[model samples]
Target: MTSNTSAAPRAARRRWATLLALFAILLIGAHLRFLSLITWDEPSSRLHPDERFFTDVASMLHVPASFDEYLDSARNPLNPRNYTKNNWYVYGLLPQTLTQYAAVMLSPQQVLPACVNRPEYSDPSITIGQPCQDTSLADYQRKIVNPDLAVPKLVWLQQALNAEGRDLTGYYEIFKVGRTWSALFDLGSLLLVFLIGLRLYGRRAGLLAALLYACAVLPIQLAHFFTVDAATGFFVLAAVYWAVRCAQNGGVISFGMLGLSIGAAMSCRVTLATLGLLGVLAVAVRLLRRDPLPNGQEDTTDRSHTAISSPRQVVTLSLLLAFAGGLALLSFRLLQPDAFRGTSFIDVLPDERFIENIQRISTFVSGEADSPPQQQWAGRTPFLFPLQNILLWGLGLPLGLAALAAWVVAGWQLIRRGNLAHLLPWAWVTFYFAWQGGQFVTTMRYYSSLYGLLCVLAAWGLVVLAAAKHLPATRVRVPSMVAGRGVAAKHLPATRVRVP
Candidate 1:
């Protein structure tokens, strides 16, 4: 009774300690991500090409006055298709809309309103030698002290006025705020990695995984940029997390979360629509009754429950999956409404323009288009190129090898013991790598979603190694007494416990 009572407090203390460690890991991750968050115009006029495009696109956007206006497919500013000026609307609408609104809210004064009354101010392309009607922007123009002033200061003010021919004045401010959002998204990935690891292994493994992801070079570098990659990775990990949850629980709420996460992921990158495969696999595992218990325990009796128990059970499962699919459609519509522009409620089809753009992008991505960037991959081997880069730069050598080893170990465990914890991530990792590694554009950012899963696998391996090290193979005999009588010595094996 005393041992049991004391064990509770020990466990409670361990939980508190784990929470503290996780909090520290988050802090470290935040520091790495947010450090020098805005660097687009740093050193020189070094604007990232993608960031410049996003800023320009954001400048052209107009927020709808009401919900009805937002829903109007033809005139909707939220829809990338409505932007008649630019034909290149391939990227997701979420980041563009988010950065646009976020910039306006955070720095309202930075935006120069459309001075339609003043033709000179109306055309942002014309250099403003004098202050405009918008008094907020005028203040910056008024701050020009002398001809010998800093070049960057003059450039910043001039760019703010130009706004690439849009009413929103400060491109720098927009990019800066966008970079902040990117950092936050990457931080979300870090936290999700922790949670996934914790779910699969234990507290120590979770912390280790979080630390590995936080310190990874690629995620940190991506966090410094204002792009969709970080957001895409975050949502993808979130989808994977919820899919794992749905597999374990087999409940309505879990499935709903899984669908929502998958929708959010696809909204960032259409390629992420393939995450539906992971969700389907989870559902299949759940249907087969192969899901592990919440405490990571195997249910020997559940083996017989693999087959459908009754027609009612089948009907219930079907309805739950339908609800999930419906939610996914609704979430995608809300996030990327432009994709549903040309379709009626009953006939859900993506816009023709969106499809065309996707097709065009696919050709470019597949090296069919003789673009300058494609030249770099001219002689590069298909799968091996991405694999080597991911090892060298994405995860670094040690972590890359460790993750690879862990994956092999995980695969072996899955085959031998049917461990779903290993199986879930392996399915995602294998599917994603197969698709991405075979692609022509093998940028490291494309593999950002794999970081969380790989870190979890590596951490699990480390934890397993530690457990094996601490637990002895042979048992020792010890003499014991029962009540008042002496008992014979018996040899008993030491049992493995969960890592704290």
Candidate 2:
């Protein structure tokens, strides 16, 4: 068969391969997340310290539908606080609100506050100073934290709470509902990794990236906890992907999508603003390169097809981007009546809160903050920590080395070409490596968000090696223009070449 004659069949084969790869990766993510979900024994287990923060926020972020419900939550002695932590408000609202709604649907019932009332004192022998009272919920929780707790008082408390017709399983179930969605987010990121690779390279690269991301330990670990990291990571990648797409297309709507994605990521983790910075940088490159909009036309006849080459088109795209960013800022503001007060979102940089946050993070990163015992040793080996964590066991040795090399190579090319679409992957790796490596006191999972991107780079490294061995069989295109000709952006077909 002639080479060009089989192009259609090859493309069809690639599509099928992509579908199969997606199914396999999704299956792996789901299986690992499921194991994590069921591993904790409910009766004797406690949530992670951070998880407690999320569930509480989830509960509070959830407004009561009825007055009675609101009163009950307000009156709870255990609750003891409002959703007023200024620092939390920075990353508040979206994840907590979304999870609260999910939990409300998945777990309709919960134990009443009175069910965990303070214990009364009563001595069995009426002695002057014998320990005689019901334990506090905080202390009681501590007693049961050990999976092997043999304390009869803990068992008695569970039995007592159950006898009151409380929905014993509902609390954990509600908390777990957020984690369930997080697994789905992890899966979504895996899918994006594949698509991004397929967009940039070819089917083999896409499949390889998807497989590596699915098998990576940190992503699997991210799925186990109910926190912003899973959602933030997914959206951060999504923002970068869409930013690339928007730059290539120059569509106003696409640019708006990029902004919303950035907002979503930031809303979950203010720290994720670093990830959004890549998108911003890429978009700036798109403007500086004078990339033409989707509809390229010189005349005022077709405003929609205006090219970025024109000043008016640049202004138009800028306005669209600003509108989207404003909307995102409004969302955060609405979450708290006092958010930003009279100040505009642009004022965040000069705001005291923002400055304080920066200083707080600086102190924490500089080994001045109160860190756990494990983190104390991290100060000794800052740079090597992330290198070992992400690239070594996390990605496997060969894959890790290839990915690291690919990041370096891709970064150099970005410097030379100044291509907007290619910048995010390189920027993502550099930002994380610098941030995480410098911070030192963190787990491998801290770098989990960018694992999908790293896998894409790793897959790309393989493709580059293959291209060298078979030079004539490969082509790369960045999708420059597609006007009246309607030439859509598509990948060059992946081909195999044999060398003598």
TM-score of each: 0.80, 0.69
lDDT of 1 at 42: 80
Report the C-alpha displacement of residue 50, candidate 2, in angstroms: 2.3
Q: Give the Cα-based TM-score of candidate 1 against the true structure.
A: 0.80
lDDT of each: 0.68, 0.56
lDDT value for candidate 1? 0.68
- lDDT tens per residue, model 2, 36-91: 57455465334565666665555433333332222232221111232244233234
lDDT of 1 by residue, 191-245 (tens): 9999888766666788999999999989998888878888999998988788777
Question: Against the true structure, what is every candidate's RMSD?
Answer: 9.8, 10.7
Best by TM-score: 1
